[model samples]
Target: SGTAVLTPREPGGLPHGLRAAIALRAAAAVQDEELMAHYRARLEACPGGVSFATFAVPGTMPEDTRLAAILRHADLLTVEPRGATRDDIEGLKAADVTEPDIVRLAELCAFLAYQARLLMGLRLLRNA
Candidate 1:
């Protein structure tokens, strides 16, 4: 069977703040009406998906914040220890990372987190 492609809906250019909130909610697997409404509103505002593409001379905060948020919601965070320079981060911010890149990065981190979480859960699942 072919793999299904899931594209992120554009959220009407909503501010990153709101968009991030919606994304975090979705990551948490929370399907409440309010969350859906927020996502819908953002999508209506930006039909082309949140401007994952930015040209603001790539600052650390946005990427840092996004990474932190993902870690918070994801079951695992994985670092490959590749040599990353400031320019790399800047480029990442400016370039539109292909959907495949995003998916791969997310999958790697999630897998790492999941494995760690599985072990932790096994040890603590019953106590809590």
Candidate 2:
């Protein structure tokens, strides 16, 4: 079910490679080796995935304007979603991201948050 978010039937402006990179970034934020490994494999399977290697790292930023904007939003979504403001959406718009793509990104981030929490809870239950 969650895999569909990364590889949707209609990917729109966000390609599978970019989606995997963003997922990898979110997974890295939570320091989950298991999640990171999953996303890494998904990324590696994507075309042009190697170009997105830097994004998987926590502090690295992309030189491309659009990618930078997306990365910024991903970082914000991962680290402090509550801090996100209209300015962030405006930033994406300024970078030429379409409205639908913006929605796609938000959904991806939201899904990652849910996935992380669910994994953590399962781990806790297993340990218990």
Best by TM-score: 2
lDDT of 2 by residue, 17-116 (tens): 8899999989999899999999999899988888787788887887889988888998999899999999999999999999999999999999999999
Best model per lDDT: 2
Candidate 2 weakest ten by summed lDDT: 1-10
lDDT accuracy of residue 24 in candidate 2: 92
Give a tens-digit lDDT track for model 1, residues 1-128: 00111232432223343333333334234323443454455444543444432211112124554443333322222332244344544454445444444454454335433544564567587687
- In candidate 2, stretches whose alpha carbon ends up further than 4 angstroms from where it belongs are none
